[model samples]
Target: MIVAKQKPIEEIIEEVKDSKKLLILGCNECVTVCEAGGKKEVAVLASALRMYFMNKGQEITIDEHTLERQCDHEYLEEIRGNIDQYDAVLSLACGVGVQFMAEKYFNIPILPGVDTCFMGATEERGVWSERCQGCGKCVLAKTGGICPVSRCAKRLFNGPCGGSTKGHCEINKDVVCGWQLIIDRLKELGKLDDYETLAPIKDWSTERAGGPRKVVREDLQA
Candidate 1:
């Protein structure tokens, strides 16, 4: 899951200051799950924008819409006619959704209403923790489902590094040593022997090093 936070209302207001007509666009995917850009968030932002203008003795026309996914062309196409009526679009989705809208519309200024944080999971309602950096390589299989790349400050490929003390990471006393957790988990599963095998250096060239990645499945293509 991708976690993001809402941008400050002041910052959002400034972006559309000159526009009398505005569209507040939200997404029904990851941003929705995180509660940052769902239908409720869209209404909140639109209402706030309207209130701000009203307090200034100026009237602003603001429309709210939540798309199934702003990142997909099929979903975005539904707004083709509606978008033309707005002077600018204030996207409440993740950074990818904002950019996708800009790419599709071309003529309008698409502004982001949230800051993209990280690939994370909901620890509980209103709490999210970073889990993956999307480093292009996945080593969770060997790490007993613990990710050192994201949780360990050192990102040590084989480590608890020399810096770890007891079971805690040296960089932050609150953080558990990722490698220690991995070792303990594997031990419980009688797979501790897996630790002896050193993982090969990740070949980033096949991952993101080459540039934007894509997958084409002929069977899925109509």
Candidate 2:
């Protein structure tokens, strides 16, 4: 899942300082699971903004709403009629959701309420860790399901980079060496020999040389 953290209240207020009428939009997907941009967060932000404006003797009208997903055209269309009523929209979804709303509602200014952190998984109730960098080329087959691209601070293809000490990353004592984890996992599965093969140099041209990349599936095309 993509994890995110809420932007500070001061920063959020500054974005809509000129707007009297605002809409606080939330998502019911990934952000909800991370407790960053869910319905509850929307209400909290709306109330905080209202309080801030009130304390400053400025009257502001803030409305809140949560969509099943802001990235989908169908879900975004549901707000077509009412979105125009507000001067600006504060999207409490991930960066993708903010961009999608901006693209669909070209006339209104859309502001992000959260900082998209990383493509990661929940480690505990409040801990989220990075797991993938979306490098396009996947080499997990040889690493026993551990992703070195994101877990390793250096993103080494075949590594424990001599900097690792006592199974911990040199960059941070708290961080476990990504390669160590990979070795342990492979050893557990009786595939320790897999480490003998080094990965080929990544072809970045195929992964990201051009502008934005797009995947077209003729089978799914209408």
TM per model? 0.93, 0.97
Worst 10 residues of 2 by lDDT: 203-212
Q: Which one is best on TM-score?
A: 2
Q: lDDT tens digits, residues 106-136, model 1?
A: 9999999999999999999999999998777
lDDT of 2 by residue, 1-222 (tens): 889999999999899999989999999999999999999999999999999999999978999999999889999999998888999999999999999999999999999999999999999999999998787878899999999888899988886999999999999999999999999999999998898888888776545565578779999999
lDDT of each: 0.90, 0.92
Where does candidate 1 stray beyond 4 Å? 206-208
After superposition, candidate 2 runs with Cα above 4 Å error: 206-209
* lDDT of predicted model 1: 0.90
Candidate with best lDDT: 2
Error of 2 at 42 (Å): 0.4
